[model samples]
Target: MADELKRRLVHASGSGLVALYLLADYLAIGLTWQYFRYLMIVLSVGVIVLEILRLRVGLEWWLYEKLTREYEQDQFAGYGYYMLSMTAVVLVFRPEIALPAMLMLALGDPISGAVSDDSLKRVKGPKVLVTMFVVSAALAAPFLSHAPLAILAAALGATVADGVTIRIREFVVDDNLTIPIYAAVLAWLVLEFVPI
Candidate 1:
């Protein structure tokens, strides 16, 4: 339980990226979107390199033992997926869509994870799904209040992504890589269409 809490805490800390972007833009700290974008790219690349070393070259880290799951011992860890998804959203979406999307993954997913019951060995139940939607919607509300449709779309996307766990052969498709990307895409679609 303590380890799970630590992992979730680390997962939630990913929100710092969005917060950093906001502070940088608000304070005119010269860490504009251009620099932030490059930073994400660089960080993603670094993560890929580290993942390769960890998975292929037998490299090990202290956090790897503490934070990784039983399934991650032989595959890409959630951290890699997280960086990939975050980088994807930052690179592909506008900040208006990307920041809230990232926030949903960072805050919403962890909150849902905390309330989930893996002992059932099933997808999250309705209550967990509802919690995910609520947290995601609240997170996006501040940024997307202007577009209620977009806000709902984003919340639904995040809830679905986080609630449904899929596996391909031996590899589990992680919500860390799906939640933000799906949420951002849905939000962008609503912003583009729906006659808002």
Candidate 2:
């Protein structure tokens, strides 16, 4: 019970990272996309460097052990992938698609993780999928109401990407990276084909 509570707390705490996406989107509204892109690049690079140093120096082991998966210790942590993928999604997609996709990733993924018991399961259960969709739709509705199909597709893609863990050899692709990218791609496709 104690371990379960600890896991829940740790998972829930990841929702705080959503602030980074919100701040970036707010800045993108006021500043140029190029400015936001450059800022994200710099921040991602800094995080990568810090992570490398942390691994080398064995710094913050307790935090990493608590927050990261066993496979992540030898590779970049999820936070590094989060920053890198956020930057990539912003650079690859337009503001309309990118913002909502990032928002779904930032908020929905953590909610799903916190609520679901996927420790023994590989795929998300119906409860997890429903929670993820509802949360993502609620958060995305205001911004994406005009593009309902696109938003729904993006939300579903984000939730699925978050629920599945993809491994490529020694590296595990964190959902922090997959969720936004998948959501953005699906949303873009919907906008392109559906005439929305």
Candidate 3:
């Protein structure tokens, strides 16, 4: 029962934060306190760094290990940090469409990796990418009718960005630097041509 509780908490917190971010964004509450969100992001990163140090010192486990572990300790810590980081960016930057898409990437990717059990269970390459495209589209849909297209583009962009960064950082770089940047660029493009 303890294990069951842990699993439920991990899943709940992991998915819950993303859902909250979406809710806040759709309700337009995030934009009102955007700076607070960035502050939260900064705080979240500091926490991750501190935790990383703790894990290194044997007081706790590394964030990535916790994220990938079957147990909840690592996931709870990792997810808590992720939620803060994501909420921070969404609030500060107003990356409405990209907010959910990126969270989907952050939350969903690790979950997928964990759930894809067995050495023989190979997720098809294109199918996996396509699945992400669909998922991204669905998540981004409420923001606008063109949200799916934006998400598809972002997913591909994210894939390429992930490939480029895989060996670069020993710890997670701010998605403020990654996913939000993509969202910013997309938002910029969307805003660029409108008659002012």
Candidate 4:
């Protein structure tokens, strides 16, 4: 159990580092990339402070542990897929999209997972799907280009990705590796096909 906890902390920290980079880029872009040098200085200092706090107070492990605990197996699979997908799409085109989308993917899904679990107590299937769809659509709308379509597709993709991974994890390989790669590929294909 201790080892598992330690492992989860390391994993969460890796995700957090990625998120930090993405967030810094997002802030810089939102600020039109001007004064990025100053922004970087401020953010770097902040990160160092946070890192010191984490070491001195165990803040990093505590937060990661809580996040890992709140996440169900299905939620973990879903989140893993979401990150991998967003990473790939952003790597190819519209790198700007990555910072916002990946940040949301990292933060939003977990929040929704916890909230939806309680809100829908005993509910299952398409009902849960619709709830996530609506929430994701609303959250994603203001951030993406084709707001409605992108949100709907992403929500649906998340739904299917979670449901399938939950059902198949026992009989097959980990969905964490498969789902995100597929999603990224799908996003890439869409980008290629779209007129843009």
Top candidate, metric lDDT:
1
RMSD of 1: 1.4
Q: Which regions of candidate 1 are displaced past 4 Å?
A: 26-28, 119-122
Residues 1-196 of candidate 3: C-alpha lDDT, one tens digit per residue: 4443453345445455455554776877763345445645775777676666555654554434434345433433544444554554465455564465445555444433343332322232544445544554555556545544555555554433322333245453432245434543454354454432
lDDT of 2 by residue, 1-196 (tens): 5544564565445444445545755656555667767777898899888898888877775666666766677777777877787788888987777777667766677678777875735676888888888887776676678989987988878877877667679565778788888888888888889986
lDDT of candidate 1 over 126-167, digit per residue (tens):
889999999999999999989999999999999989988777
RMSD in order of candidates: 1.4, 3.6, 6.5, 9.2
The residue-by-residue lDDT of candidate 4 on 89-135, one tens digit each, is 44443533333344334433443344444332223366555654565
**Native-to-model Cα distance after best TM-score fit, residue 2 in candidate 2, in Å:** 8.7
User: Considering TM-score, where higher is better, how would the candidates rank from best to worst?
Assistant: 1, 2, 3, 4
lDDT of 4: 0.44
Among all candidates shown, the one with the greatest TM-score:
1
Query: What lDDT is reached at residue 186 by model 4?
Result: 37
Candidate 2 to truth, TM: 0.79
* Candidate order, lDDT descending: 1, 2, 3, 4
- lDDT (C-alpha) at residue 98 in model 1: 94
lDDT of model number 3 = 0.47
Error at 30, model 3, angstroms? 9.8
